[model samples]
Target: MYTGMRISEICNLKMVDIDLENRRISVVGKGNIYRRIPLREDVVYMMKEYVEQEREKSKFADSEYLIVTQRSAKMDRTAMLTWFWRLSAELGFRIYPHKFRHTFCTRLIQLGVPILTVSKLVGHSSPQMTARYYVKIGMNEKLHAIHLL
Candidate 1:
């Protein structure tokens, strides 16, 4: 969720795609386009740990993929969805991977991030596309707006 990458992009992530020192990742988005996304410090830290600890312990230690399984196989979208489903079942809530993209956009909008900036961050073709599809003004924001007067 830190990076608003598509599931396909996340699934295809390679270790080289991450620039931990730079605190960003390069992802291949829809239409095979590449984009760089900034990462939070915690996310970068966790990625480092995962690479140094978990990945090294796996049979796929030599694998180029960022995330791998015990069998040393690169994960696909189906595997990601299955994991999300299992986690949602355990947590007693509806959760899905794609929901994260929406949440990411929503959170950015809630923070008063401009649509143009958000669009660039999320790899939208234009601010109009981002505003038309992703931005959701809820009851809370509506109420808050009225009270601002």
Candidate 2:
């Protein structure tokens, strides 16, 4: 939720990809491009705790992947989807992994982050691509724009 990483990127994340001491994560996005994302303090703390307490308890703790499945050492797309489906059912709402990426991009744009910066963070090839697809301008924003005129 914090990082605008694609579902595949998240699933493919390795322990080496994360630098908790440096507060950053390296992900390979589309086209096998690599990018480093800075982590917030809260996220870092949570990750630290998860790694130390929860992940360590798993039988697959030695897995190279940061996220491990109870049945397998590595988490794949199917496992991720199944998990999301169960969570959605339990919560009585549709929840998917990509929703986090979308929310991450939308929240950053809504917060007045530069389109170029948001685009880069989300791994879009261009700001125009991000603007065309993910930049949602709501009724409130339209009203605010008209008032500014």
Candidate 3:
């Protein structure tokens, strides 16, 4: 939810990819491209807690992956989807992993962050691509723009 990484990227994240001290995540994105995303302080603390307390107690605690499953050393896309599905059922809402990516981008754009910066942050090849696919100018934004004019 914090980092706008793809589901595959999140699933493939390794312990080495995260630098808690620096408050950034080194992501190997699509086409084997690399990008560094700054992390929020709260996110850093949560990640640290998850790693030191929860992940440490997992059966696959020695796994190099940041997230591991009891059945496997790494958590795959299927497992992630299943987890979201269960959460969705319990929460009485349709929640999916990709939705978080969309929300991340949308929230940044809504906050008036530049499209180019958001593009780089999300590892998009171009700002146009990011604007075309990710940026949703909602009715509220439209109303706001009209008021500004």
Candidate 4:
């Protein structure tokens, strides 16, 4: 979700979905429609390392899935949720899987990114959806606006 992709989209990501040279990932969103999202430099590096070092060394080295279960099969949604639950318990904080997507969108909006751009990046159907949900006005922004007056 750090990529602002839904958990299902992430789980469904395959080796073919990524274009490392171009730093982009193609994913099927809510309506099974394909959308492209740019990957950050760090994310590109991580993907490269994961595909080469970790995935290559795994027993299911030939698996096309981006992320896999211990058996080398694609990880199920339930497994992902269980993993997050265990992680939250270990970290002593609430960790909802969907919240990562929210955080990604919220951070971009908070950083003053254009709503249309943010919506496209996160594969939202329209800018309206992004603005309605993720674009929040914080106190700092309010104070800055007041100061500008």
Residue-level lDDT of model 1, residues 2-98, one tens digit each, is: 8888888888999899899999999877766668999999999989998999889988889989989875469888888989999999999989988
TM-score of 2: 0.93
The TM-scores, one per candidate, come to: 0.89, 0.93, 0.92, 0.88
| Model 3 lDDT-worst window of ten | 133-142
- Model 4 has an lDDT value of 0.86
lDDT of 2 by residue, 1-149 (tens): 99999989988999999999999999989987678999999999998998898889999999999998888888899999999999999999999999998999888888889999988887888899999988777899899999999
| RMSD of each predicted structure | 2.2, 1.4, 1.8, 1.9
Measured by TM-score, the strongest candidate is: 2
> Which of candidates 2 and 3 is the stronger one according to TM-score?
2
User: lDDT scores for all predictions?
Assistant: 0.87, 0.91, 0.93, 0.86
Per-residue accuracy of model 3 over 1-149 as CA lDDT, tens digit each: 89999999998999999999999999989977789999999999999999999899899999999998888989999999999999999999999988989999999998999999999998988899999997777899799999997
Give the CA lDDT, 0 to 100, for residue 61 in model 4. 73
lDDT of 3: 0.93
